[model samples]
Target chain A: DVKVTQSSRYLVKRTGEKVFLECVQDMDHENMFWYRQDPGLGLRLIYFSYDVKMKEKGDIPEGYSVSREKKERFSLILESASTNQTSMYLCASSYGELREQYFGPGTRLTVT
Target chain B: AQSVTQLDSQVPVFEEAPVELRCNYSSSVSVYLFWYVQYPNQGLQLLLKYLSGSTLVKGINGFEAEFNKSQTSFHLRKPSVHISDTAEYFCAVRPGSNMLTFGGGTRLMVKP
Candidate 1:
């Protein structure tokens, strides 16, 4: 089975604190994505990386940034966390030709 | 850009009851559709996908969805649902682009 792993399962941060959520995939997939899930709104893409060091903004990327230094790792960064940024974050990876994506265990972030 | 709409916000049904989750997509061009399920505190899992070929697509957990191009809808149906079927279902579309746009999810609550 393809496995995607997130560094943290739950996190709590104070306002203005810097936060990082890490994701790693073992399938050597070329595409990786970051999303935040909220009630009723489903999952909104925050950012995605098609290749190393390359990123594109998703529907909601205002207070978030991402890093893809290597093919196996993708990281989500909150420059300065706010209470509104509290949400469940998910990471996914997919092969270049496949339409299906494998996801990691989500990180429930609570920024107080 | 591609977008998806899932009409039902929450559907509560009894165990062993048939269920249908509706989805529709709008885009200027062609697109691919997918259904994903997310359990509480877990990541999203690919329930099914429609890339090409036949319209009816069967997926894991006895769930299936049919792609109706004329109607621009892909509705998920299950003959019977169990308590384990309780989860949030998301409809997504990829419009000849790398990014996948997801709909606001529909939460399925199966009662005993």
Candidate 2:
């Protein structure tokens, strides 16, 4: 089974603090993605990386940045946490040929 | 750019009742379609995918989706649902590359 693991299942951050969410995949997939899920809006992409050190913005990338220093690791950074940024964050990875994405257990962040 | 639209926000069905969750996509090129299910407080799991060949594709947990190129729709269906099937279903489309555009999820509530 493909395994995608996130650093934290739940996190609480204070306003104006920096937050980091980590994701790792064991399948050696080349593509990694970060998304935030809200109640009715579903999941919206924040950022994606096709290769190490290369990142692309998704639909909702504002106030978020991503890092891909290694093939197996992808990190999402909230430069300054705000209450509006509270949501369930998800990470996914997929192999090149097959577009099927495997997801991690998600990190629910609460900013207060 | 590719986009997905899920027609229903919620679909409540009784146990053993048939159900259908509609999804439609808009894209300029050929696309890959997928259905993902998410249980409460968990990440998304791949239920089925339509890459090529046969239009009808079956997935895990007795779920299936048919890809309709003419109508630009990929609707998920189940002959009978169980209480365990209650979850949020997301329909996603990949237009050309690894990036996937997701639709607003349809929450499936199975009541006894």
Candidate 3:
């Protein structure tokens, strides 16, 4: 089984604060994704990386950005966190398109 | 664009009883279907996936789902549920592409 690790399990931040969420996958998958999970919204993609130094914006990428300087690591960045951004963030990786995606443990962010 | 719909927002079943969670999806092209489980305060875990070839797919925790293409549905089922099975279940559909579109999710409560 592939193991994906997130840097933090819980995070707290004040409004307008910059926050960073990190993820690492040991599977050496080619595709990485970042999503925000909410009560009714399920999981909405924020950004995704198909390869190192490559990224694409998902449906809700307004306040989120991503960085992929390394193959095993992918990071999500919040330029200015807001109360609305307080949710669980998930990271997933897959070896190829439409393959089974392995997810990280997730980070629960509380923006006050 | 792909979309998934989970019919029941919450389902309550007694321990050792059969349970079913309904899921429907819409996509123009071929898509992969998946069910994910999220435990309390934990990240989402992949329960099962339907890629191709077979209509019935088995997953972890003795869960199974059948892909009904004509009905546009992929419902999850389990003969007997345990107390530990109480959690949030999410239905997701990927349009043969990398990104996945998820349903609103259904919470399953197995009581003793």
Candidate 4:
């Protein structure tokens, strides 16, 4: 089974604080994705990496960035956290174009 | 552009009753369909996918979905549901090699 793990299960931060969410996948999948899930909007993609040091902006990428220093690790960074950024963050990985993504336990972030 | 739509925002049903979650998509290119379930406060888990071959795909925990190309829909179904089945379900579509576009999601509530 593919295993994806996140650094934190829950987090709280003040406005304007910078936040980092880490994700690691056991399998050497080439694709990694970050998404923020809201009440009515569902999971909206933030950023994705297809290779180490390569990233692409997804539908909703404002105020967020990503890093893939290693193949197994992907990180999401919020330059300046705000109350609007408070939501569930999910990380997922898959091989190439395969849609069978393996997801890590989400990180519930709260910004006050 | 590819997009996914989940018609029902929430569905409440009694335990051991049949349930169906409707999903629709629009894409100019061929697309892959997937159904994912997210337990409370957890990440999404792949319930099933339709890439090719069979139109009716059976998934874990006695859940199944059929792909209807003419209607451009992939609706998930289960013969009977339990309390454990209560969760948020998301329908996603991947057009070609692009990133997946997810639906708003359907929250299933199973009552005793």
Among the numbered candidates, top DockQ falls to 3
Q: What C-alpha RMSD does candidate 2 show over the true interface residues after superposing them?
A: 1.3
* Candidates' C-alpha lDDT: 0.93, 0.94, 0.93, 0.94
TM-score of every model versus the real structure:
0.97, 0.96, 0.96, 0.97
lDDT of 1 by residue, B1-112 (tens): 6778999999999999999999999988988899999998889999999998999999999999999999999999999999999999999998876588899999999999
Positional deviation of residue B20's Cα in model 4 after best superposition, in angstroms: 0.7
Cα lDDT of model 4 by residue, B1-112, tens digit:
9889999999999999999999999998888999999998778999999998989999999999999999999999999999999999999998878888999999999999
The positional error of residue A79 in candidate 3, measured at the CA in angstroms, is 0.8
**Which is the better candidate, 1 or 2, if ranked by lDDT?**
2
Worst 10 residues of 3 chain A by lDDT: A96-105
Point out the worst 10-residue segment of candidate 4 chain B by lDDT. B92-101
Tens-digit lDDT track for model 3 on A1-112? Answer: 7899999999999999999999999988999999999887799999999999999999999988999999999999999999999999999998978677888889999999
Model 4 per-residue lDDT at A65: 89
lDDT by residue for model 4 over A1-112, one digit each (tens)? Answer: 8999999999999999999999999999999999989886788999999999999999999999899999999999999999999999999999978748899999999999
Range of the 10 consecutive residues with the lowest summed lDDT in candidate 4 chain A: A94-103
Off by over 4 Å in 4: none
Using DockQ, rank the candidates from best to worst: 3, 4, 1, 2
Model 3 clash number: 0
Local error of candidate 3 at B102, Å?
0.7
Please give, for residues A80-102, the per-residue lDDT of candidate 1 as tens digits. 99999999999999988455889
lDDT of 3 by residue, B22-111 (tens): 999999998889999999977788899998888999999999999999999999999999999999999999886658999999999999
Q: Whole-model lDDT, candidate 4? A: 0.94
